[model samples]
Target: MRSSRSWRLVVEAFPLLILCIGCGPASTASPTAKPATTASTAAAVASVEPDVPVAQPEPIAEPVDSPSAVIEPVAPQPVFRPDDPREPQDDAQLAELGIRVYESRRLKLYTDIDSDAARTLPGYVDQLYDALEAYFGPLPPDRNGTDFQMTGYLLKDERLFREAGLIPLDLPPINHGRHRANEFWMREQLYDYYRRHLLFHEVTHCFMTFVPDTQTPVWYLEGMAEHFGTHRIQADGRLSFGVMPTSPDEAAGWGRVTLIREAFADGHPRTLADVFALQPADFLMNDAYGWSWSACHFLATHPRYRERFEQLGRDGRGPRFIRRLTELFEPDGRDLATEWALYVVNLQYGYDCGRAAIDFQRGSTLTAETPARTVMIEPTRGWQSTQVLLEQGQEYTITATGEITLADEPKPWVSGPRGISIRYAEGHPLGQLLACLRAEEATAAETMLRILPIGEGRTFAAPITGTLYLRINDSWSELADNRGEFSVTITRAD
Candidate 1:
């Protein structure tokens, strides 16, 4: 997410409302098309300008009787240059053809939608620029020290843009959005938030073009776009970029979380390596986007890996980008894989990385002098280490005692080790005590941790030699609302 005051400058500039309509030559065509355009466009625009009547085109002036009386030739409007510097267009001409143009410090948006939907969008893009700069460092300025700016076509009618020569003939047909150099094109989306999301996603691609000679992997490229494109706009009009959506209501039509949960539930969860190996063709389906986003979000936000992950932005250019990234995590690769598995298993909206982080301390084996170990397992945390390593084929007895407050909203709902019966997570009772073995050599996400129910007491032979980790089973997204802890004791059994 962006800093607290990231939108201060934008808010000051566009207080109350920010839709700045451009002044241009009035349309010379019939007003019938404008009504149809509004009716067929996204609902956001219609809500903004519900009943505004379209203006009739200006009438052509009759030829003057005295042609030579005083006919000063009108100077043509200056060509607007996008960041690419390859093709420029006359801004006034585009506006005259029913396209409304919006400009900011970093973007020039041309669209045929009503002005209401365009409100505060330019400022929002400017805010996005600030966020991109915050994450990837400031982009290098041109020779004159001017910041880069891009051109975007947010199209409501593809035919209109094609007829106006705005869309290149050679440009490939896009279902949603595409970007090249400093220009991007996207069709109007069904929802307003999704429309902005696709816009930011493409704009992120344009921003990354500054990295010279970058042969960055396809996963990183698209993942980074997805990472930066997820955003939230507060009810007060404050804008925040790169945020995880807390609920479905807040981010309508953005279903990355749902896709991930469904994929994992179907037993096809993509491991970190699986995500890394994804090819460009894999992105033709939406599932690839979900997996890529999960991997990037995990590495970028997790405390242990975030520092090294952020270095990818600074040192991740050139053909050796993937090689360098692999080398960076190779040391902790096993632990990372285990943690990633845990993350995916519990993935949900508003996932808290700090609470889910596992403290990996190698455990000492049970001995004659040291027989048992007790660990405090917190309800607000994902997993806690017991510092006791069990041997393969050896039996161990586990006992936990304590009460915990699962929630305090309507009233404090307390539960013992047995947990509540009304709700369940991962097919287990909510707030039930759960156990898992984390072997040092286990690197595959699918088999790294096998959770077993251990409510109150249980005696079982070790499935494999590994450290013992325990937790109060609960929804990953709802961990923050929980309170209290459990006292769990482990001892070797005869």
Candidate 2:
């Protein structure tokens, strides 16, 4: 009877296991013919626009640093605490930083990530919780209204992290092929960082909680943080700020930025303020973080945009308000989607950051076995083709240029934008991801977007390009954010 049951199980699952494999005369995974073009032809209706500018004051730098400013943030005094080769940190001192943020921000710093998993680290955890209460007021982990939990996570190292469980960005040596653990940062590092920079980029996510927390594009969610997250304290009260794309995580945004900069890089650069008025929503075919960074950069630096951001910061996060905000400015750029598509094509042709002669093969799907140092194109606009046909073996990359939308559809299971569905490989683990993307002593109901679905869909162009990606996986079935859709373009850079 036991032998018979074993045979039956194998028979029940084989064919469904792998839809396709290895490229050949015609690998099972090969996309069915619809049309294969290096890039989809741009419809004239979505006219591309010119680059705008960030309107910052002539001496804006002086004011922020001055003592009389409203924020009056004290900068950190500089010191050189060289990294100890002997005490080599297995990973970036990220976990330590996580621990600190927990304590300082929430005042529940006792619960340490490295501490025993069975119970919470009271001191670390308490501080983290306390800080949350103070900043935007109370927020129970379970519910805040938004379907998704705008949260973050930390992990120790590659091996232990993968062993613990995570969705690998890619296979073999791909940066994303395997799972990279994102967990909590220890306490000291978190405060030290905040004191110097007078920044805790994480708090920006809190901004979402306060407002409708509407479907914020990836740019606003991460780009704003990247812009402000870099400040560090000098013991003497001077602040040192790192470029927004400081780390591998943040550096990834640059791939997209380079293209836009190049577009207006020559002759006269566009004003940052006018660029902000372009409204990312209007541009659906570019990398999200890059676009958002540029968008935020305009607000942070452009003289006019500086005033705009200051004004908006005073207002709530709502479509009506944002729409009203746009009315106050002039169009600096246009046709964001086309500009984005062209940028990816350029890199795919030859923008070696230090890898292959041409590492990225542009198309809906990528063919490299290596990991992407940067996400070349993260789509934000939703599908607007009026038709989308996807297959398991077929992969695609979406640059998050704006808020993308998706058609209504049921998926195998995944988190993020609604109407998204995709299947992940068998080895992928969903439980660990849920645990990792959280505050150290996170309550049971934290709405962190930890669930990785094989695929997700939304009208937003960036979020719903296709299921083929380097990292992230399923267990994300219910968390799909498929509320709206956006116009999208598919590419075949090869």
Candidate 3:
């Protein structure tokens, strides 16, 4: 079952910035107040203003920059034959035209567009934002809301894309970055999605200002946008998205799948307090997007999301969101985990009581069986510091002992197996460590694992919510020195 993970509650190391280009927005231009589902590109442009920091990927490999984290470009250079499908349009000279469109529509959006395809931005904004606000709710008046704008650096040359680690589109994947006044690269096709999702997502950042500090869970914010990504223009012209996701389509990107996978993997509820404690760094953009999106989706898309959102809105944040939902299922209403279990069941199965816009998935419990074996670890060699890989939605414990070791004194040796590791502070990064923990290992567990803790197992919860993709450090501690042979177990955490 898809646990109810709240975006506001999760520790968002950094915001994700992705624009799939095809689907992910709500727009209605050509006329009228134009359903929130639609807006005049000119109106949307006028409505958009300012900017903010925001949002992923590799095959789960490769390095990515978060709001503050940056990695050098990957190898196996990428080449786009001047005429790739994502080539920028030739409309650079029309920034003023875009300005004119913004002026005409009264929309609050970016005024400086640098693409060769300029004048059309107004129309795009109108239709794009109109559609977006319709599905997610109106953009907030300021940063408190989700309204946002950015200086789009349309990439026409391969050098531009390469600079952002966007080349080798085949080598895992890398997403660009954005902040209030900083720069972000975008493919021509990306504009299509950005003008829709990323743009609105930034706008959502604005809406967040209105969110009561107490009610702002990391899960709701991202999940709502991600959940809305599946929206489509219905025959009646109304926006709609009701039906369990089926493969990949234009309306939703592969991002949808990633969200579900994370929610199922991250299988429980996390507190906003814990999330707030994380370093304010953009480490895992993909995880942020997937995790936040799932967190929100698990709440709003659920049968009880509306009630919870309403209660929290009425009460103005605090414990209402959690308390209200807990009351909905249990008598005492304390088992937040059970509430999450309920959410997983609802999402995994989805609901269609006949309203509109209801989309969820099957809970992981339905698919996952109990682990045959479970135990804690101090993993070593071809492994990482924290490699907690249990079936999604299952529980397990981590145990370790002082354990025995074979000492080989002050002799310089590099053959056989020498457990290598790097230690980092609280604000340190797993991505950075993963890049360094390589000595003839591949599988994540093998490439970077830690072992021989000074004492017992590092007791912790399985990462069963948000983006489950994580890497541990190549660190370890012996009774005294650094060279020794040790063994630990990774069985079920029963």
Candidate 4:
């Protein structure tokens, strides 16, 4: 059964960003079925203001003066031509349009685009291949030792795209790309900014077919594709990601993020537990795709959950998705929904994953000095925790006091106590140490437990004479101005 991960606590002064975009399904279309809605190019472009960093892919080997500076083009190479006669008679009309066939070791391209666009096709496909391979592992070969080669049909315009008959004409123009089996089809953009973005997104669907049919949930199937689909190609062709927006001007994914934020504010945010229960066919809402992508982004790139997320994929079973979630998130008695709510509300482009993991330690020991010691919790300190020794039947008091100053919002006091008292496991020191060393590194769920709330602070007597691990947390106020300090002082009760 899906756990009711509730979110009733109100966070005062949670000022969120204002942006807008309509939600849609993935761009991939099944020829006979309704087109899967993808993030619309029009919607993506509309959401980005002149100041926001436009989401785009870096050209392979192009040098940059600055991140915002336009990428210089590489010297033109010849367009692709097939080594042998091209089969697939459906593309006959494209051949008449002076189409060129570019064949690389791993991909085959069919497009009417000129040499400039055609030359870059190989590099783009190669970049997507490397990125997808890194995350999902290498692709399996067919009966023939030759690697499975994916074919891309890049139509010159919507008219040509429609005439090609790859996607049904009934689908809306917003559907820019579609992946059918091992083939990918996409229409060319006039002023292409997210051209590579759309290309990678569709191709990712083709690559996903290799995963064992473990009845993979629709959210994961589409979410992971969109997650990698948003990957930024580096100058040297290596993939670079996990870049959270440092400034307002640098924000990307305004459309998807805006959609999710609005939903969350409306109290209809898609929860992980909810996503797990859904099948792919049923997850047809546009926000579902967007939330799925964000969820995948949170899990795949976030330092704390990366490994476990990969395991979930490798395990490739639907049940494992929920099982891992229960084990990793709810174990600490911290509701996943509450944590996710805070994450999406403040989410912007270029989120920093590594920094977040360090700031929010999952299973680490905190050093606490005796009697009256004050431990500071800062915005940069995500969820660092510590352990204090207490005698059975002895009472200890904990209080948190601080105020966070945002850019344009009121300075709210770092609300209520954010600490959890963990009962010490009874075991031999050597045995425990060995087990700790040998055991899978503990995740947040395995180590942390429910906070014993007593007033705005916790004043409780120890039930056993042992060390009590106190986890210091916040309301997930990850705003840039989340830069404040809360001091925790622990003392024995009279």
TM-score of each model, in listed order: 0.80, 0.29, 0.36, 0.57
Q: After superposition, how far is residue 10 of candidate 2 from its true place, in Å?
A: 55
lDDT of 1 by residue, 181-260 (tens): 67778877666777787788878877776544434666677778888778888788767876777765556566777667
lDDT of 3 by residue, 318-337 (tens): 44444543344333122223
Best lDDT among the predictions, by candidate number:
1
Candidate 1 ranges with C-alpha deviation above 4 Å: 1-83, 443-448
Candidate that would win on TM-score: 1
1-494 per-residue lDDT for model 2 (tens digits): 11334333322321111000110010111122211111111310122112111112233234466567676455643322112112112233434333322322232222224444313223322333344344333432212232212222232344443442322333222111111111112111222222212113433333333322223333444455445544433477443332333322222212333434444435323332233333433323333334445556544544334555545444423343444344433231222222223223222211222211112222233335421222322122211121222223334333222232222354322233222333332234321111111112223232122333322221122222323222222221221432322223333222
Candidate 3: stretches off by over 4 Å:
1-195, 209-217, 228-230, 235-246, 262-285, 311-336, 342-494
Against the reference, the lDDT scores of all candidates come to 0.71, 0.29, 0.33, 0.49
Q: After superposition, how far is residue 90 of candidate 3 from its true place, in Å?
A: 17
Ranking of models by lDDT: 1, 4, 3, 2
Q: Give model 3's TM-score versus the native structure.
A: 0.36
TM-score ranking from best candidate downward: 1, 4, 3, 2
Could you tell me which residue pairs clash in candidate 1?
none
lDDT of 1: 0.71
